[model samples]
Target: MDPKETYSPLNCPKPVAEGIWIFDGLMIRMDLGPFKIPFPTRMTVVRLGDGTLWIHSPIAPDEDLFSAVDALGSVRHVIAPNSIHYWYMADWLERYPGARSYAVPDLATTAKRPFRIDHPLMDGARFAWESEIDWILVPGTKVSEAVFHVPSARTVILVDLIENFEAAKLSSPLMRFMLKLVGGLDPNGMAPLDLRMTFRPKRKQVRERLQRVVDWQPEKVIMAHGRIYDRDGAQELRRAFRWAI
Candidate 1:
């Protein structure tokens, strides 16, 4: 059976802000040596002022997803916000051949598969949407993740930096146990414990960067995994990073 035939839209992209739409992508299962379970993922679509779409963390592309995106504008930029988020980048590139692909710095070396990277995303790098979107590199982690802030919407887009997994979403007992041990279960999910440990030596630097995020005064916070904070985003962000900060 063809895998594409099995592809079905999980959550169609819906507007969260004026120019931003988010959708829950298909669940991805991971084998963490001793455990295996399907985990939900998401994709964010931002329609720039110029009517071009900026895709963040590309997910499985299907007719429904493409139709929704096409109704907005041409897909012009594909962004891999972190090294681990490059899974579906090649597919997006194939769909939007003209779109410029940007990956977080050092992704070429860390990515599990090959994809065309037009340029490396750097802190404060300027783009066509620079006036509206600002990006910063979250420091002190094994994976380089870039956090983006859209001034127009007063929103922040995060990848793996902060994950909020609900208990009900865990299908396996082992998965629940592991998530509980790492503090990834519902109600208080923040960054994973192991990922936070990576910030030990660079905690200070990471805090400074997070402080800048706080300074943005974001109203909405979107994470690749888990529920989005539609209100008090800044406060939630501070709480999420309290350990590292």
Candidate 2:
């Protein structure tokens, strides 16, 4: 999927899954405004096999995006996986008042300021989403508390663990320097330079967490920061965080 075509001039197209669909975002460069970014952000819409839709991550502030999401099946839940991502949850929840909000425990309390969070994610816990998506908690990230595994695509959806960027065009000195330092412009960007030190103490935990991830033997890794890994997923994950290997 070419970023420019898939999400460029327009917002991410709706992706229909086993009852789920994805409404990606407008790519925004730090220098370029939201509409002018050379890249885009993708939001996930998980419709459980039961027809209950779970909206993950935040959506753009545009009215069209909001209207599009409303057109989907009944939204039973809204998730702000981590602390830093709840900014858009308020609008979404307001629009769909019937949908209950859930967040990581730490974020749940704080997220209350904007939305009514009804559930807190627990580590090692498993939740039966749709027949197609089985979610598990990956408790080491500072913001997000879990990652999702989609067995059908041999895909593991990680909100902040690994990110695959198209380095060719994003290789500009500014982008490179920034990515090499603060990490990417989004949550799943490769380990930020700051997180490297923070994650040092949790190295073993992170490794063990990944071990469980490997148990899934995922083929595609979907990260929120950059592009998705379609092949050699395991090796690419190891390379994403050098310490994990």
Model 1 misplaced regions, further than 4 Å: 1-11
Q: What is the lDDT of residue 26 in candidate 1?
A: 78
| Tens-digit per-residue lDDT, 169-224, candidate 2 | 46355665555455544323465554455556667776777677777777666665
Worst 10 residues of 2 by lDDT: 30-39
Candidate that scores best on TM-score:
1
Q: TM-scores of all models?
A: 0.91, 0.76
Question: Which stretches in model 2 have alpha-carbon errors above 4 Å?
Answer: 1-6, 14-20, 27-40, 109-113, 124-132, 141-144, 168-172, 181-189
lDDT of 1 by residue, 38-125 (tens): 6678889999888999999988788888887788899999999986889889998998899999988888887888899997888656
Model 2 lDDT on a 0 to 1 scale: 0.61
Clash counts for all predictions:
0, 5
Error of 1 at 17 (Å): 1.1
Leading candidate by lDDT: 1
